[model samples]
Target: MNQHDFLIALLVFLVAAVVAVPLARRLGLGAVLGYLIAGAAIGPFALRLVTNVESILHFSEFGVVMMMFVIGLELEPRKLKNLKKSIFGYGSTQLAACALVLGVLAALLGAPWQVALVAGLGLALSSTAIAFATLAERNLMSTPAGAASFGILLFQDIAAIPMIALLPLLAADAVGAVPHGPPAWQTAGKAVAVMALLVVVGRYLVRPVLRFIARTDMREMFTAFALLLVVGIALMMDAVGVSMALGTFVAGVLLADSEYRHALEADIEPFKGLLLGLFFMAVGMSIDFGVLAQAPGQVLGLVAGFVVVKTLILALLARRFGIARGQWLLFGLLISQGGEFAFVVFGVAAHAGLLPPHMEALLVLVVALSMVATPLLLLVFDRLIAPRLHALSRRKDDAIPPQHNPVLIAGFGRFGQIVGRLLYSQGITATILDHDPDQIEFLKGFGFKVFYGDATRVDLLEAAGAGTAKILVVAIEGMEDSLALIDRVRARFPHLKIYARARHVSHVYQLKDRGVEIFEREMFEGSLMMGRRVLEGLGIDPADARSVALRFRRHNIQAIDRFYPHYRDQTKLVSLARQARDELEEMFRQDREQRQKQEDAEWS
Candidate 1:
């Protein structure tokens, strides 16, 4: 395209993305689907705003490569090794099972065996971009379902290389001709040799070069090197006919132990996000709407049929693998769509004559439509299904034995434990209630008496002697929970004095609103102590440091009290805070001058 056309295309893409992504997210569909929808609307089949879909898609596939590299950076060699069971066990089983079932279904539908096999393999792969995006967006990447999904996707990326290699053999068989490529053994050897070369280069060469670049302290240069590394690896992998993503992923893992890993990730992230978004849009643009129009029922049926089959298979695998019951359907639906690799696979198959043109077009539409359907399906599941499952899965509150201790602690975590221990040391025992069963069991092993129950529940609070207890300690970790417990105790047991833990200044205001006079901002005293020590380290007299800390604490407490009435007004709150800071500084300056005068008098 010419410069003008390129600029126009960029403008259209940016405008579409800006308009579509937020709307999709506002509607709870997600940004991936938004990009896809934007692509489809401006694509040739729709608005005809852009016609060169293939070139854009080819360039944007590097986004997948970059994403894999970033993901690999998170998995150290040890962690990757730890995932062997999931990668090979669950991953291998899932791929084999899905391929077998889908391939059989294809053959049963009268597709030639070669075409059927290729189709099954292509469709068995799930969209890594979509799955990872959803998982990361939901912050589920650390969950069991996320780990399992990653393992499956990682395996699929690795497996796609061989699948691509298999195309020639399959094509040759289909056409009753001898295979034209180098011998299978030679190809395998070359792949192995290339991987070994990468390992050697990454371990010996890449780190030193990165170290040299980092010493220059040019952030842009570091970013440039990071991109150069990925691009170079991709080119090398493509030359060897290996999956560029897999190659870059290995490079990332090799650098996982490097100090530059975070820097590399930070540098590469923007490129990855943009490219991945572009990749999704390209998938959207590539959707063969003409093929859909030609055979709508067949196309829609294939999309629905394959998705249901894949989801059921994945759900069963999740159960077998002992993924959380609540996440079983989630794990399935998150990855059931035909992946981006399918586009490449089917395209290759068509070129090699393994798949006929009409069938290839149909398969492409099926994959794209399935990609479009995933976010919608997940939105429905999240809105309708997940809440009910969560409700059913919630553990019942543990029974609390009757207690009459003078002190009732709502949470026995770090903050409450210190209070409880201090009270116990003084021969005063408090009744402690915590909701975390694991913590309670562990603490019980240390001979501490603790009950497992949500303290916000009035019944549990009463059972823990909140009504008769002289003091109720609201030390729950969650701000909302602490506030709720304070409200409940104040309402139910008005005679009880409450000592709450405030997480921050906002929390202090909230506690004050609830009439919690004995509350402590959790970090205030410790921070003051640290500040005093820091002053001493800076050559200030010890006595002066202590006085300064004490004075600062008193000033802060007075400031909090003054700020309370205006807490609901952000403008007033900020203004008062700034004014208080200046006043405190002035007070400190005067104290310093007074101390100097006192020293002068003593010396005289």
Candidate 2:
């Protein structure tokens, strides 16, 4: 409570985090486990140095908020659209199925229905932060299995909204207790109003506010304004008793159109990392080691049950849903754990008379142990399941049209296919530069020109297209290499107005620094183009359609001017971008509506 204790707690947390995280990661585990181990080590069970206190949880709560904010930043409309089937279908089904199966088992074991439901939901989901970070670190996110795992995680995150609402109702004392804090109806009403406000502001207001902020050209003010938006919205959402996580998600989704979305993500990232670490540590602290020591068998059994139950369910579900066997196996194994929200739900249940404290403590241990062991189970999937699937997947490729373009495309195994095929139709000559020399030469005898070269190298760039008198479309693979190519090409070939691909907003900044004009990222093509087409498809004339798109384009282009510079800073970017998106979207909406109204009146 005092400054001395606060500083000590801070030091202990920072020191524990710094030490434990890298150690776990080096051992092929994730930071979540490190934080848990760190917390446990420093608790009375080990070091007995930092006394657990109420302030610790409050301090760690900020981490959860920051993490959620970043998560919100990443939940851009375009990315979410790409993940629609996985998030809504696989993710939804996995959570529900896991919860139902676990709930039934718990109920059969003499647990009350309410406690069983709450406990089951706790064990049904995996940690998104851990799974994603670990997979990305291993460069496996692009794999089908990896993507499937991600979809389920993203869906679980979105599902947090309904879970929050459901928690109170699941509490047996829900009808009696809620009258103390604003009436339940009032809380529900405020939540609805806040969400409605987010939609309206996101739809009609965000863009113009950003445009106005742009006109001012005050960079510091803009960043401040962005953070203000995140905190303000987060605060308002918290005030209405909605989880700040869900609020930030909604805000992030709404601001997907804003130029500052990526900037906001980068800015908010570090704080999210720290605070989220704290949140995980707090979750770890909640685990009753005493209960575990007393009933190690029961604790370990609960964890094993989740491993077996969730894996079987997810495996069968993935198979029935037509996921590749390897992918199905991966999906099953990866999701065989509980999530952080288990602690939140359990605490609420205990408070609401839904769960006995002794039982609640046991559930906490189960969730903690499951989370701690998650990364290891992933190793099982990778070592045992994935390779088998890869081997089996060979036969299925028989039906796949063979790669026709001789240009050995490295990344295009997906994105590069279009460019390669269009060139094929044009009868243009090319050779592919890929890291896999074997794959390259294997296709070479098949009447395709394939070669092995690191595309980022100047020699490789030249070999691909630097001086052979043809265009170089620098879709040369990863963001780093792609941006490196942009820089290299700019200096080498002043004549080439480079069309560099931007993977994220950070990549956009790097390209922009090289004065790249035709920069394309996934979102630009995926949603922006789709929106323009939808308008035209609705019988809107080409002129109006182009004008509408042009207006958004110009606004976004200008907004990018601000977003690019503030890429690494989080606090200010969130507030400013949120405001800018609010302002700009409204101005554009009003202008478009006014024109439409005039056209309607004329027709009348």
| Cα-based lDDT for every prediction | 0.91, 0.71
Give the per-residue lDDT of model 2 (tens digit) for 1-604.
7899878978988898899999988986666678878877776545777667335766666565665566556667787788778778878888888889999999999987887888788778676656665666677666766777877887776666567556666563645654234545676788899889988987778767877886898876677767677778778877877766667777878876678777667667766777778766766665667788898887898789877887889889987556765567666766667775666677777886788888887887787777767767776667776687766654311111233333323344445656776787889765565555446556667676655556666655554555543355666567776766666766775664465556766788877777776767766757776788899999988788778888787787788787877867888789778978998879878987999999899999
lDDT tens digits, residue span 315-408, model 1: 9999887797889999999999999889989999999988889888889899999999999899989899989997787678877788899998
Q: Ten-residue segment with the worst summed lDDT in candidate 1?
A: 390-399
In terms of lDDT, the best-performing candidate is 1
Model 1 ranges off by over 4 Å: 412-430, 434-454, 523-551, 587-604
Per-residue lDDT for 263 in model 2?
Answer: 64
TM-score of 1: 0.91
What TM-scores do the predictions have?
Answer: 0.91, 0.63
